[model samples]
Target: MPASIHAAASGSPTRADGRASFQKARRRASVQALLLALPLIVFLLSTFIAPIALLLARSVENKEVPASMPALSRALDAWDGRGVPDEYIFALLATGLRDAQQSGQLGTVARRLNFAQPEFRSLLMRTARSVRDETPPAWKPALIELDERWNAPETWRLLKRAAASPTPDYLLAAVDAQVTPQGNVAFVADNASIYRQAFLRTIAISASVTLLCLVLGYPVAWLLANLPATSSNRLMLFVIVPFWTSLLVRTTAWYVLLQPGGVINGVLMGLGLASHPLPLIFNRTGVLIGMTHVLLPYMILAIFSVMKGVSPVYVRAAQSLGAHPFTAFVRIYIPQTLPGVGAGCFLVFVLALGYYITPALLGGAGDEMISQLIALQTNTQLNWGLAGALSAYLVIFTAIFYFLFNRIVGIDRLRFG
Candidate 1:
């Protein structure tokens, strides 16, 4: 065979070994990459995905008592509305309470029922006490006398209603409901429909703040984006200076500045600007001022970041083409900055929707956001189910906003800008 042909057919032994070794190294690198991603995958699954899933579950978790006490649910399933419940129904309640106590979820079961009928907690406690204190033979009669109508089919019906689970029953009530037995629908009582209103009000206030930020930040960002690097750096220090202080400090500073006797009023008085102190703090005006100050930087940063990428040549070119300054900016310059506008709007809007501290400090009764109500439910009422449900709804609202924002303006546009 020719030397070249022989070399091609046999290959070099060292070259073959080198190729095999390279394949092994590549396989090892692939395994290393997979290993490195494993922790992050696990962390996201556990901390982010898992908790959100559980929270969503809690928002609709209604079946615990009924599932545990199937026999009671079945026994009560047939009865008419006239008579007292029988021994089987008592057995179901006893079983449900025992299982609830065992699972350490009696509290959860109790609270759901509490929303339907506030006396449910006391009923659960009494039933638990009755089960512990009285002998088995006396259980039915004693419980009947404790509430003689307890034997009535309506009483058992209420228990079954509380026992229904994995349903939107909680969501129904979260929005305010008088849920009916025959249908899944609820009638929203005119007086009790606060949640829907609160949700709307929250969205409105958030949008207002976002608009204020846009109106106020646009000029500032435009100026900053046009300045010399040193001037821009010095100007940004004013924005960043607030970050160095605690959020509470910034909020409190607004309180002092806006208060009747504070610096702002003093200055106005000195300047003969007003005869009386302005009602600035502890109201809607105060909330607007404080939130606009707090969230303005986000707007500025978003706008400035996008503005930096926009070439001045575009405006110059437009002018060179016989466009006036305003026309060039509006027709050419402004379109280029829409991505930034969308980003800053999304950021400020989302932040403002969940705003708790600034609103709580500055807003009066009418201006309280949903976050404040969630806090009240969790802390004051100790109603975790309601709080959890509210949180779930808030997350849903935020997700809806994010989805719409992404649809209206792609996330890529925001990120690249």
Candidate 2:
């Protein structure tokens, strides 16, 4: 081969080798980066992601009936919903109840059934006692004799619904709706419809608190941004100090301050602003005050951070061009601080949505939020499924608000420092 051809061929192989070497180096770097991130990935999956997955799973989980009454659940799956199940199913039910009662699983099954219909728990317990105490020749008649509800088609349908695993019943009930015996989706009775109103109250409170924070925090943030460094730093402490205090302590302080005979009401009555002590604590007014006070620091810091980066020249120039000071501030300065406003509002609103201790301490029964209901289900009722469902709805609402905020204000532009 000629020298030129040999040189060209050698150069091609050299370039190819360079390309391969580059690819190998890139792959090695990628592996190193992944190794560095592996711990964090594992931590997130174990702590955050896994727990959320479990919560979502628990929302639809209906294992109480199927696990405790396996035979009855399986037999009910085959039965049509026209009327009460056959005598064979009744026999399975009696056997299952006896086994469950003996195994100490009857309470779990009864509790799960009661969630579907309030009276089912007592009915099941009464029948289970009868089944355990006596051996009936025909379980259908014996169960019917024990409770007339056993003969009702609606009772059978409720049991069948509860028997199915991975059910929507909990989720439906979370929204104050339910699946009827006829397999139709319907709102619960007016008296039973609480979750929907709770959800609305939660959103309403969150929005109100966010608005209050913004209204109260904006001027303070502007002052902090405009003041000398020494003055601003001293003033910033006022905002930061409360933030450093424990949340429970802060809420408790507010609880004392806003009570009927506390400082606020005392001041008002002393000043002759009111004839008597006001109903400040344990109402919507107290909830808003407590939440706004707690969240104000966040709003002020977010806006101040953004304002620090914004030049004063813009507003000055606008004012020099014959605009009033307030007009210049609104038209020039306010728009520049919008990213911070968005960040602060979103943060405060989301935080307010999940507030438990503050509201529980300060607000009354009528002002109960969704978090209160979730706690009631989990702690008082021992209904993890309902709690999970409520949490799922809260998560969904947060996600929706996040997307809406992202779309309207652009999440990329949000500035929180």
Candidate 3:
């Protein structure tokens, strides 16, 4: 064989070496990226995604009671709430309550399970007391007679409800929905449908605020975009100065500023602009005003950042061609600022939807947002399932908003800087 042919056959390869080297480099780069991304991925999962996933899970977290008292749950599972629960059911409740009390977690369990019915505590307390006394099964009649409320249908219903794993009762009640009289599918009561109304009010308020911010912020952004650099910078500082103060302080300040006897009305009365003080604070007007003030900066910043990058030459060229200033602005400049408008509107709307302290403190009962009700359920009513479900719905809505925004307006076109 020739020397060259021998060398080729001996695997003095050229193409294979290049391919092998490229694959090795690609693999190393991929490994490096994965290593660099690991901490951030873990941090995001733990802090952001994990909590939200847990919250979503809590929407269905009805297993606490049933899991804690599995034997009781099984005993009550077949027993309907039509009449007094059987002796086995009572014994199960007694055992579970004793266990819960011993663990010092009865309060937490009671708070969660109470959402099914209000009279759970008395039943639990009575059962816990009697069961610890080593009373015979025949003493059940005496126990029933001790508190006849124990024999009530609703009381049994409450127990039977708690006995089930993954009850949807609290989640339904959050929206004012509940199981039918037959304990079948859930139904919403006409008068108790406050959640739907509150949901609509939230959407409407958010939309109105977004519109107000756009109308107010657009002109300001245009002015900033057109102004001398120093003047624009000074104005931007004033716009962003609100960020220096705490949100709570800003909201409280609005309450003070808009209250009937506060600065605005005081000045109005003093100037004889009005004979009587206007009802400004503690209403929808106050909510819109305070929210707009706080959110306007977001709108302005979003718009101004995008506007800063827009070329002024388009407008100038249009004007030079004898186009009117308004025409030039509308034709040449407005289209370019749309991405900012959409982005700012979306940001403001989502923020408004989740607003709590501002509306709670500054607005009246009529103007209360869904978040206030969620807080009420979680704190005052001690309805964790409902709170969790409400939060889940809010998260779902936010995701939908993001999806729609991404679909309708390319997020890539929306400027952040």
* Regions more than 4 Å wrong, model 1: 1-52, 63-85, 94-111, 124-142, 151-154, 411-417
Q: Considering every candidate listed, which one attains the maximal TM-score?
A: 2
Q: Per-prediction RMSD in angstroms? A: 4.4, 3.1, 3.9
**Cα-based TM-score, every candidate:** 0.83, 0.91, 0.85
lDDT of 1 by residue, 1-417 (tens): 976667778875566778999999999999999999999999999999998777667777766566656666566556553456667667667776776677787787677667777787788877876665555765577777776656666556677666555566667767776556554577686666788778888999899999999999999999999999999999999977877888999898888899899999999989999999998887888999999999999999998999999999989998999999999999888778888888899999999988999999988888888999888987887666677788888988999998887776675455434
Candidate 3 minimal-lDDT segment of 10 residues: 408-417
lDDT of each residue in 1-417, candidate 3, tens digit only: 976677689978566677999999999999999999999999999999988787667777677677677787787787755777767666667678788878776776666556666766666666667777766656457567767776677666666776675767756765778776566766566666788788888999999999999999999998998899999999989898999999999999998899888999999999999999999988999999989999999999999998998998988999999999999988778878878887898899899999998898888988878899888976887666778888888888898998887665674455322
Better of 1 and 3 by TM-score: 3
Candidate with the larger TM-score of 1 and 2:
2
lDDT of each: 0.80, 0.89, 0.81
Candidate 1: RMSD to truth: 4.4
- Candidate 3 TM-score over all chains jointly: 0.85
User: Clashing residue pairs, candidate 3?
Assistant: none
Candidate 1 residue 215 Cα shift, in angstroms, is 0.7
Clashes of each: 5, 0, 0
Error of 3 at 334 (Å): 1.7
